[model samples]
Target: MQRYFVQESHWQENKVTITEEDAHHIKKVMRMTEGDSLIAVHPEGKAYKVSIESVGESIICVVREEITDNKELPQQVTVVQAIGKADKVEWVIQKATELGVSRIIPFQATRSVAKWDHKKQDKKVARFEKIAKEAAEQSERVKVPHVHRVLSLQEVIEETKDYDFRVFAYENEVRNGANRKLSEHIKEMTPGTEVCVIIGPEGGFSPEEADELYQSGFTSVRLGKRILRMETAPLYFLSALSYEWEE
Candidate 1:
């Protein structure tokens, strides 16, 4: 069944109002009509199985069934991903959302090649957010994951200060037994605790950036023997978190 997300205000008595892009998508794109059955997510609550009762300037779906169940990953995994080339970052957002990451933070690292101007950054992040939301719904996630505005290394260092568990994937830390530490770190995550993970850029993090993150309370750990690409790191991290918490 088709799944829709609507604001709580859309619900009044026995009907729900859907407008703007969603209404257009249903009326024009999908060509759904009255009596069509589909699933939906309420703005402030859970998913529902609804049947379309009206289709006009505004579409209304009557609540046939509502599901309060949540299918989010076991932990609150926040990926502080380095802002890379355009398409690469978008891929990260989509994949991360599908993997059940709770939040995504785009940042600039020392080796980052692309820089976003104010206007471009706004447009870019908005696009990624749309991608994230669609991916979330497709994955049957209870809540949509957020894609935050772009930040710099300094900003990320300060932003993650309040996170309960902070980690960074660094090859340098391997000499310090980074792999062993990653294994041990997995055993320590609390079920619902917020974890902040810092992933490097295309060319990877500079020594200075890595060191600064470490000083900011982010534990530098290794993903494995082979270096994962900038886009691949977050998926691996979220998968590991899922395995640790869910499996």
Candidate 2:
């Protein structure tokens, strides 16, 4: 069944009102009519089987049942990705959502190639969020992962204070033949732990930036012996996490 994330105000009792883009998708794209069934995810992450009661300017659905399956990762994982090329960031947002990331934070690293225009940051963040929503629905995620506005590396470090564990992918580790894999660090994580994983840009982080992050308590972990691209690093980390916790 198709899935749509419904806002809290749009829901009343067992009925849900889906409007705007999702309504268009149901009416034009899916051509769904009355009595057609789809899943409606609540803002708080609850999902329900909903049957279309009416389809017109808006889609009105009646709750059939609450879906109990949890598709989220055992622990919350936030990807702090340094802004890279536009396409690469979009790919990360899509794939990371499918991989069950809880949130994405794009930051401006010392070596970031793509710089965010402060005036247009909201538009860029909105676009990233749309990609996340589409990916979440396709992956059958109960909730869409949030995409934060671009932050400075220092701001990101301050934000990590709330996370239970924090790690950054460092290619230097691979160069130094650091044997500690991401798996080693993540083994210390338990269910519901909040984790933050940082990925550098294409040019990678400068030595000074790495030193600062290390001082701020972000453990440097090697993805493997090989160095992954900026966009690939987060996916690798998320996959390893899924293997350890889900599989």
Best by TM-score: 2
What is the Cα-based lDDT of residue 203 in candidate 2? 82
Candidate 1 ranges beyond 4 A from true positions: 174-181
The lDDT for every candidate, in the order shown, is 0.82, 0.93
- For model 2, give the 10-residue run with minimal summed lDDT: 179-188
Per-residue lDDT of candidate 1, residues 173-200 (tens digit): 6545543746578778888788889898
In Å, residue 94's CA in model 1 sits off its true spot by: 0.2
lDDT score for residue 40 of model 1: 76
Give the top-scoring candidate (lDDT): 2
Cα error, candidate 2, residue 83 (Å): 0.4
Give the clashing pairs for model 1: none
- How good is model 2 by TM-score? 0.99
lDDT of 2 by residue, 18-40 (tens): 99999999999999999999999
